[model samples]
Target: MNMCFVTHKVRKGDGQGRVNYEVILEALRQGHYVYIIASELSDELAQHERVIWKKIAVEGWPTELLRNQIFAIRASLWLTILRNRIDLTIVNGFTAYVRSDINCIHFVHSAWLRSKYHPIVERKSLSSFYQYIYTRLNRSLERMAMKRTRTIVAVSEQVKHELKGDAHIEGNRIAVIRNGVDLEEFYPRHVDRRELHLSEQQLYAMFAGDLRSSRKNLDTVLKALVSVPEIHLLVLGNTKGSLYPQMAADLGLGERVQFLGYRTDMATWMSAADLFVFPSRYEPFALVLLEAMAVGLPVVASSNCGAVELLTNKAAIIINDPDDSDALADALLRCAADRRQLKQMGEEARRLACQHSWSAMAAQYLQLIQETALHKAVPLPES
Candidate 1:
C-alpha cells in the first residue's frame, strides 16, 4: 500500500511528531510505500529508502499560527494534486485538509478552548489574545476537516468524547488509540540519588513538562509541596522566563522545590525519583506520565489526564481536582507514609507501561489504516 502522511513535523521529541515517526517506520517495515508531507523531517527519516519526504518550507512568519496555517495550506494543495497516486492519506488534526482518509487528532483544540486554566482563558497579555484567536480559528478548521474525515483517530477517550460532544463528530467514526511510550528507552534503571546530588533519605517527587503553562497545574504541585515537607519536587522541562520559580519562592517552597530545567536524561531523572506528580488541568494524553510509569515510578496525577484511565488498582493515586493542592498534598503524604505500598505501586506502573509499547501502538494504527482504506463509504453525521 502507498500511504501518505501529513504532519507539521516528522521528528522525535514532540508528542505527535514522535507518534508519526514511529508509525512511518512501522509502515516501512510492513513494506508500504510511505510518503510524508511535513515542514521539518529528521535526518534518519529523510534517509529512509522506502520513505518519500515532501518538505514544505515554512518561514518568515511572525507567529506560529501563521506558519502552521501556511504549511497546512501548502500540504493540502499537494495532497489534492497527489490524491490520485496515493492509496490512503492519514493526517494529524493540526494539518488536516482535503483528501484525508484518517485524521489522527493528538489534542482537541475545542477541549483546550473549554479549559478554564488554558492560557487563552487565564492570561491577559497580547500574546494570549493572539493565542485565543488562533485557537478559535484552529477549532473551526478542525471541526470542518473532521466532518470530511472518513475515520478519526483520537489519542484518548476524553478526546473522542470532546470530538462527539463539542465538534459534533459521530462516535462510530472515531477510534480511541492512546499514545505510547518507548519502553526500551524508558525502563527502570538503578540510579543513585548521590549521582544527582540528592540525599537517599530525602523523598523526591518528579514533575515534568512546560512549567510556564498554567494548564500543566505546576502551581498546584508547588502549593502541595508546602504541606509535604519531606517530599522534594524535581522540576523538569524548559524553565526560561517561567514564573514557576518565582511562584515557588512566594509560596515559601524555595528549599522544597528544585528546578532542573529541560534535561534529555528524563528516564534517569524519573528512575531516580520516589514518585511522579502531574496534576494537569487538561491533558489529552501525557507521554511523560507513561514514561514515568515505564521507569517504575508511582504517579500522583489528576483524573482529568487521559493516561490515568489506563492505570488500575493501586498503580496510581488519581486526584479528582487538579487545582486542589490539599488533595495533592494528601496523596503525596499517603505515598510517603507507606514505603512498601509505594514500591508495589511502582512495580504495577512499570507492568502497565510495558503493556503499551510503541510497537503495539504502531501495529494498531496500521490495522486501522488498512481497515479504513477498505471501507470507502463516507461517515454518517451524528443526529
Candidate 2:
C-alpha cells in the first residue's frame, strides 16, 4: 500500500519527526510506498528510500496564526499533486487538508492549546481571552480537518478525551495507539556501572528529557532528591532554558545532582544508572518512559502520564500525585534500598517494552487504515 505522512517538520532533533521517520521506514520495510509532506526537512534524511519530502512555507507566522491559517487545504492539495495512489494519509501534527479517497489517520501528540509545555503558549498561561478565541477557531479548523479524516490516533486516552470534549470528536472516531521505543537501540547491555564514577553498592537515579515548563515537575523531582541524599540523581537531556541547574544549586545538591544536558548517547546514560525517574505532572505519552523501560531500568513515574497505562504488574511504580515530594522521595528510596525488587521490576519493564514493538504497532496501524478505507461511508465526527 502507498502511505503519505504529513508532519510539522522532519529532523533528528525533533522527537515527533524521528518517530514518524521510524514508522515510515518500518512501513517501507514491509514493502509499502511511503511519502512525507512536512514544513521543514533535514539533509540527513533526504537520502532515505521510497520517501518523497515536500517542504512547505511555515516560518514567520506565530503558532496561533499558523493554527488558524487558511492555507491548510491548499497545502494538502499541493501534497496530493506530488503523489500517486495514496492508500493512507497519516497526519502527524495537524491536517493539511482532507482527502475523500485517502484513509487519513490523525495522530494527536498532546493538547497543543491546553498544554503548558507547548512552545507557543508559555507554561500554563493561556489567558481566558486567548483560550476563548483560539479554542473556538482551532476547534473549528481541527474539526473540519478531522471530520474528513478516516481515524484519529491518540497517543494517550487523556488526549482522546480532550479531543472529544474540546473538539466534539466522538470516542469511536479515536483510537489509542501509544508510541513505542526502539528496543535494539535502548536495551540493557552490561556496562561497568563504576565507569561513570560511583560505588557499586550506592544507589543512582536518572532523569532524561527536557526539564522545562511547569508540567515536567523538575522542581518536585529536585525537592525529592534532597529528601533522599543517599540516592544520587543525574539529569540528562537538554536544559536549553530550564531553571533546573539553579534549583539544584539552591537545594545544595550541587555535585550530587549532575546536569548532563542534551545527551545524544541516552542508551549509555540509561545503562549506567540503576533507576529512571520521571515525575511529570502531565504527559500524553513520555516517549522516554518507554525508552527507560526498554533499557531494563526500574521506572518511577507519575500516574498522570499516558504511558503509565502500558505498565502492568511489577513493571513500574506509579506515583499518583506528582506534587507530593514525599511520595516521589519514598519511591526513589524504595528502589535504592532494595536491589532484588529493583532488578525484578527492571526485568519486568524490559519484558513489557519488548512486547510493544514498532512492527506490532505498524500492523495495527495498517489494519486501522484498511478498515477506515473500507468503511468510508460512515460519519467521521461522532455525535
Candidate 3:
C-alpha cells in the first residue's frame, strides 16, 4: 500500500508529531511505501530508506495561523496532483483542505471554544483577539474537510462526541482510537531524589505541559498546592515567560512549586514524583497522563481529560470540577494521607499503561486504513 501522511511536523518532541512519526515507522515496518508530507522532519526519519519525505517550506510566517494556512494550501495542491497515484491520504485535522481518505483529528476546535478557560472567552489581549479569529477560521476549514473525508479518526471518545454533537459529523464516519504510550521508554522505575535535586522526605507531584496557557489550569494546581502543604509540584515544561512563577509566589507556594522547565528525561522526572496532577480545563487526550501511569505514578486528573476514560477509581482519582481548587486539593490530600492506597493505585496505573503500546496503536490504524480502502466510497460534499 502507498500510504501518505500529511502533518505540520514529523518529529519526536510534540505529541501529534510523535504520533505521525510512530505510525509512519509502523507502516514501513509492515512493508508499505510511506510518504510523509510535512514542514519539518527529524533527522532520523529523513534518513530512513523506506520513507519518502516531501518537504513544504512555510517558515517565517508572521503568525502561526498564516503558516498553517500556507502549509494546508500547499499540501492540498500536492494531494490533488497525487490523488490518483496514492492508495490513501491521512490528513491532520487542523490543516486539512484536500479530499482525503482519512482525517485524523487530534483536537476538536469547537470543543476547545466551549471549554471553561477558552481564550476567546477569558482573554482580553490583542493577541487573544487574533487567536479567536484564527480559531473560527480553522473551525470553518475543519467542517469542509470533514465533509470531504471518507473516514475520520478521533483520538478519543470525547473528541468523537464533539465531532458528532458540535461539528455535526456522522457517528458512523468517525472512529475512536485513543493515543498510546511508549511502554519501554516510560515504564516503572526508581530514581534517587538527590539526582533530581529533590528532597528525599518531601512528596513530589508532577505536572507536564505548556504553562503559559490558562487551559492547562496550572493556577488551579497552584491553589491546590496551597491547601496541600506537604506535596511539592515538579513542573516539567517551558516557563520562561509564564505568569505561573508569579502566581506561585503570590499563593506563598514559592518553595513548594519547582519549575524544572522542558526536559527530555520525562521518564526520570515521573520516577522522581509520588503522583501526577493534571488539572487541565480541556484536553482531547493527555499523553503525559499515560506516560506518568506507565512510570507507576497515581494520577489525580480532571474529568475533562479524555485519558480519564481509560482510568478507574482504583487507578486514579478524577475531579468532577476542574475550576474547583478545593476538589483538586482534597483529592491530592487524600492521596498524600494514604500511602498504601497511593502505592496500590500506582501499581494499577502501571498495569493499565502496559496494556497500551505505540505498536498496538499503529496496528489498529493500519487495520482501519485497509478496511477503509476496501469499503465503498462515499460521495464528497460539493466544494
Model 3 gets an lDDT of 0.88
Better of 1 and 2 by lDDT: 1
- lDDT by residue (58-166, candidate 3, tens digit) is 8789888889988988887887777767888888885657678899999888766666577878868897889788878788888888887889999989999999998
What are the lDDT scores of the predictions, listed in order? 0.88, 0.73, 0.88
| Model 2 ranges off by over 4 Å | 10-13, 40-45, 57-74, 80-85, 97-140, 377-383
Regions of model 3 farther than 4 Å from truth: 376-383
The best-first sequence of candidates by TM-score reads 3, 1, 2
lDDT of 1 by residue, 1-383 (tens): 99999998888888899999889989999999999999888899899888888889887888788888888889988888888889898998858457478999988888788878767678689978888888888999888778767899999898888888888888988999888899888998889889889888888999999976788989899988888887988999899989999999999888888899899988998888999999999998899999999999999999889898889767999999999999999999999899899999999999999989999999999999999878866554442
Across residues 1-383, which tens digit of lDDT does each residue of candidate 2 receive?
Answer: 77777776666546576656666666767787766777766664567677766666666677655643634655678666855667667775345755533322333332555554443454244554555466556556666667777677777776787777766777876877767677778999887867767667767788877676666788888999898888888788778788889989999999888888888888988888888889887777788888899999989999878788889759788898988999998988887778899999999999989977766776676666667667766654442
Query: Residue 334 deviation, candidate 3, in Å?
Result: 0.2
Worst ten in a row by lDDT for model 1: 374-383
Residue 315 lDDT (model 1)? 90
- Backbone clashes under 3 angstroms, per model: 0, 2, 0
TM-scores, each model vs. reference: 0.97, 0.84, 0.97
